[model samples]
Each structure stands twice: as structure tokens, then as C-alpha cells.
Target: MTTPLTPHITTPITADLLRGALDLEQTAHGVLPHRLPARARAQCADGQLAMAESQPSGVRLVFRTRATAVELETLPTKRVYVGAPPRPDGVYDLLVDGRPAGSATVTGGSTLTVDMTTGTAEHRPGPPGTLRFTGLSAGVKDIEIWLPHNETTELVALRTDAPVGPVPDRGRKVWLHHGSSISQGSDAASPTTTWPALAASLAGVELINLGLGGGALLDPFTARALRDTPADLISLKIGINLVNTDLMRLRAFTPAVHGFLDTLREGHPTTPILVVSPILCPIHEDTPGPSAPDFSDLSDPGDPSDLSAGRLRFRAAGDPAERATGKLTLNVIRDELARLVEQRSADDPNLRHLDGRELYGEADFAELPLPDRLHPDAAAHRRIGERFAALAFTAGGAFAPEAA
Candidate 1:
């Protein structure tokens, strides 16, 4: 008499398990997580927003299972800049019972090659890849599979050695955060390791990260989205995106911020709203932008390897004199944000402002320079996340339990 074979369980991926994404679109192969809802996406035809939303920087697959082994099949759309340095493979982090258990990386996926000089991009199809993790602890355990923060992933399938079910909510406060690419996990090691993710874990809060890369231009729709989304705490990291993109002048900036806050207050009348200015970016600290790629020291174009080795840097192209004409820089934006929050807090006691410099100032910058002079690297992400948690989530802090 032979023993019966143990059966594996396959659960269909659904929205309930997802936390940070605003929308989920079912594809023929599987599902794609989007940070912006269909309505929001429809409002803006900007390619940057489209790309940023599709990346799902803070999105993860969460569940509870007794399984000892798990596997996820995905088709990630990896981006490649034609003349820029090669990016590392996207990492999928697995957490068991709130702790990191294992990690894996997909080997193959579609490639999106972009020419920054020409502003043109092309997509090339590639094969799907699988991530497998085994040797989990016994008994029921909470599990989270964090998607790559940089790559746009399409989930294909999930398999477990045992049945999986939704984890019961621990009644954690939901923190809704909005910001630019640094907050979008650029140069971050993994999804769960992103600054927002790290802060959320430390604060024991569920996160709804709206950290759109290059898309955090203080758009009315984004503020509207924040207003509609439910959250116990909210934070906005503004300034860098505006400066780097040279999106607006001080004349237009102040009113736009007020309008954005007004829209958010309409829905969250009493919620704690923290306004964080951009962290230290020396390149744009005083220099006005539209930041431009600096390929100045790069070797001659014939060799792709040399081209790849040539580190890409960004320079502020806007003149310092432009400030007299109402042009905005990081320093100017920070000052404005501080003053705005202070003025608003007189009547709106829930408003608070934290100097972004306190999080990553000159001292920290000297120790851990930004890799691209724009986005923070993995180690810096940790430093910023830890600092944010200590400053904003601890006692007497903006998001402290008593404050909330």
C-alpha cells in the first residue's frame, strides 16, 4: 500500500492581498499592479506618470499560509537606457512572519531600451522567470512577496505547498505617502527595503505609497487621489521633482500647493498631514533646474562597454539668476514649504512640517553621496528610512500614536 501524494495548492491572486497599489488590471497572462487608478491614469497622458505607476514600487503580495515552500512566476518589464550604466536585476523579497526569510531575482524578462539623448524608447520581448523560496518555518505564518521597485512586473502565477489565506488585519494605522522618484525606490535594493517600506515596517503601519517617479509634480489629480483614498496618516515629500523638472515657478508654486492641500483637507479634515521638503541634493541645492544629463566626461561613443562604464551625472541647467524671475530651487522650495506649513498650522493644527535636511542633510550627504546625484542608493534609503521613523513615528512625533 503506497502513501497518498501531498497535494499542492494554487490560489488565484486577487486585490485583497495587495496593499499599496491603487488598482489592479487583469491581463491574459496574469495581473498587473498599478499605483494610480484608471480614472487618474485617464486624466494624464504623460508618459512619465504611466511608467511610474506601472512600476508598483511599494506593492507586495501578502498572505498567510502553512506552506513550507512557495513559488511565484512573473514576467517583469525591465527598462534599459541605451547609453546609461546597466541597472541591476530586480529583486523579489520574501518575508515570513514580519521578518525577511529569503530573496530571489528573475533572470529573464522583456526589455525596454531608451535613448535619453533622443528621448525615444523601444520594447523587446523576453521570456518569463520564476522565483522560488523554500524551508520556511513550521505552522501558520504571515508571508509577503515584495515585487521589484524599479521593474514593471506582471504576475503570472503563485504556487504553494499548502493552502494560503488572507492574514487577519492587525488594525494597523494606514499611512498614505506621496513623493518623487527617491521615494519611488530608485536605486533601492528591493521593494521592502525602500525608505517608505522601511518606515512603514518600523511604524507598524500599513502603507499606501504614491511615490511616483518624476510624476510628483503636485498635480491636482494626485491631491484628489490622496483625498479620496482612506488613510489615518498622510505625508508628502515635495520639491525635488519640481526643481529637477523645472515644472513651475514660485509664482505658480505657492498657490498650487495651497490648492493641493485644500483638496486633501476636504476629505481628511482631522488627519495628521506632514509636509516634508526634499532631502539634500547638492546639485540642485542652490542651482535652479531643469536638470540635464551630463555626459561630459564620457569616453568616445564607439565602445558600448566604455559607454556603460562612463558614469551618468545630472547638472542643473537653469541659471542662479533665474531666481529673481521667480524660478524655484531646492532651497527656495524648502523655505516656502516651511512657511506654508507654519502659516497653515495656525488654524489647521494637524499640519506639520519636517525639514528634509534633518532626514538627509549635508553631513549624511558627505558620508553617503547619491549615486546619480539625484536618487539615493540602498544604504542611504536605510539611513533616511530610519531617520524618518525616529523623527515622525516616535513619541511626540507627527505620526506618534498619541498625536494620531
Candidate 2:
């Protein structure tokens, strides 16, 4: 439970206070319906507050900030629609600074109106999307937003004329996670129920999600991001994507993982970092993804021959041993991650490793087919969340509560 508190609200919206975007980041032409501009960040993780596990119930969350002005800008010029899909039916409590400003009900796929004439907006008859607030003070101290239930909230875009401060929530430990789409909640029911979101909720710890959808290619930029960020608890889920995407060769795959970890160690000298191998996705379990366009798409069954240059292809009758003998299989990734941890453990005890299959395996897949045959469904999210809570937040773990 969050502590109920009020924040100052005297400041007014100003030109210098707005903090989202100065110019439109990009045009939505040719992009998928649910896709957003590159500059637009998923709103689910902002202003996050996590408590220490075992802390007394009734934790308080207060965002003390003022707004100068808020702009609910639109794209496509004329009568435009910013579609927010996958939201549930509910009346949200939109707080300005700390008081109730307005309410918006989000209907998945419905376009919430962003009237250009008046900054006032209304919902599309379902659930709510982004709740834009404007005219905020330049020095708005704490701008608190709360969710009535554990439902997922997706904020599309916000431009405020205020300088938002650090989140007021406090915790001794921070949890960092890096992975592919499943970790990014692709095909999951909603943003908050994504396995990582579920896991974070149960553990009661701060989270910095680096789960990139279709973008976790073991790129150096990603490793540098993880290496530089500060954290108390960290976990990296690998393998499944490597197999599904066939993004790297065996020679390049192993060294990339090592380099990613080595760089992360530079910033977090003693932080506990856990590396998790991919969970079981039978489609690529025994087969290297064979460097093809995503075959997981049931609708298209993309061309196997055109996956891209230097990509590996999964053999239709691919077997685990055969897959391991060639490219980056789940088992192969697991072994590599374990070896990385073992080698690093010679000098660092804070680094840890977990097999993702332990959280969800072939059996779970029988009951719940990942919507895309890659990402988990809602029930699986719950299962993974509970398992992670038990493993990562137990006594002596980073988020464990203090002894009473």
C-alpha cells in the first residue's frame, strides 16, 4: 500500500518547464498501428516506487511536483487518432501534482481525444491511455500518479512545462533486468502484467527495465547501457531470442555475452547481477532460429529464406543436440551464461545466474501457448512472478525486509 500524501501545487505551467518533446520526434507513416515514435517511451515504468520486501504494509508514495503547462500533441495533423491498445475498462484517477485533475476511461484501440482548441481530453469509451496535465509549475516538487488496481497503464505521450524531480519513493535495493521481447512484455496481456512487471510487483523493489522488443540483439549499445546503469539486483534472460532470431554466429555469440557482462561490471562494482537463460519455446528449443524472418507469426509464416543476411535458419526437424552442435540454442546459452558467471565468480561473488526454464518449461507451455509462441500469457506471467518473488526476495536477498 502507498502512503497517502499531498504535494505543493502553486506553480504555473511555463515554456521552460515542459519536458517531453520540443519538436515532433517522428512521423507515424508506414509504422504499425500500435507502434509509437522512437522518442516516445513506454509510460508503464516511469515514476516507479518499490518497497523493501517484508516492510510493513501501507507504504506511502508521494510525487511532489508542479506543472507549468501540458501539451497533448497529436500526429497526422488534422483529426488524428493515437491508438492505445490492450487497455482494460476502468475509470482512472488522474492526479495533477497531488490532486484529482480529471478522469479518462480507456477503450482498447479507441482514440482518446486531444482537442487542439482546449487542452481538455476525454476517453474513447474503454480504459484510459495517457492523462496529460498542463499549466504545471516549473518547480513542481512531487507529481504523484496512482493506479487503483494492479492493472497495466500505458502512457502515450506527455509534454509538461515542469521539471519533474526524482521519484520520492525510497528503497535500499534496485533490480535491473535485461532481455528480449518476453521481458519487454510482447504479446503479454498488458504492460504491468508482463512477467517482469509481475516479478517486480511481488518482490517490492525498484526496477530499471532494459527489455527491448525485437531489439535485444546482444548489441554493444545495450551492454553499455546495462554496464553503466546502477543497480543492487540484476538479471539477464538470454537464449530464446538468440535461437528465434538467429542474430549471431556461435563465434560471435559467446564473446558478445562476455563483453556485455564485463562492461556492466565496470559501473556496478559489487552489485548482485543475475543472468537467466531463455525459457523453453519448443519452436526453437532444438533448432537454431536459422536466421529467418520471424516464423512465430502464425498469420504469415514469413519466408525462411529471407530472414536477412548472415542469419541462421531452424531445421524443421531440428533436435536439441543438433541445435547445440551448431548455433546458439537455449541449452547452449544456458551453459554459456553459467560459465560466464562461474568465471566471473572467481573474482566477483555478486554476480548470479538462473536458468529461465526453471520459471517456465515445456509443461507450462502445454497449458499456456505463448500468444506468439515466444511470449508468455497472463497465467504464465503470474507463475513467473511468484517464482521470482520466492527466489529473489526471500530472506538475505537484496529486497528482503529488515529483521523485526
TM-score list, all predictions: 0.95, 0.60
What total of clashing residue pairs does each candidate reach? 0, 49
Best by TM-score: 1
Off by over 4 Å in 1: 1-7, 300-307
Residue 190, candidate 2: C-alpha displacement in angstroms = 2.5
Q: For candidate 1, give the lDDT of residue 26.
A: 95
Candidate 1, 174-198: lDDT as tens digits: 9999999999998888899899999
TM-score of 1: 0.95
Q: For this target, which candidate reaches the highest lDDT against the unseen true structure?
A: 1
Model 2: lDDT of residue 117:
31
Report lDDT (CA) for all predictions.
Answer: 0.89, 0.51
Q: How accurate is candidate 2 locally (lDDT)?
A: 0.51
lDDT of 2 by residue, 319-367 (tens): 4565535666766777777888789788877766777887888788888
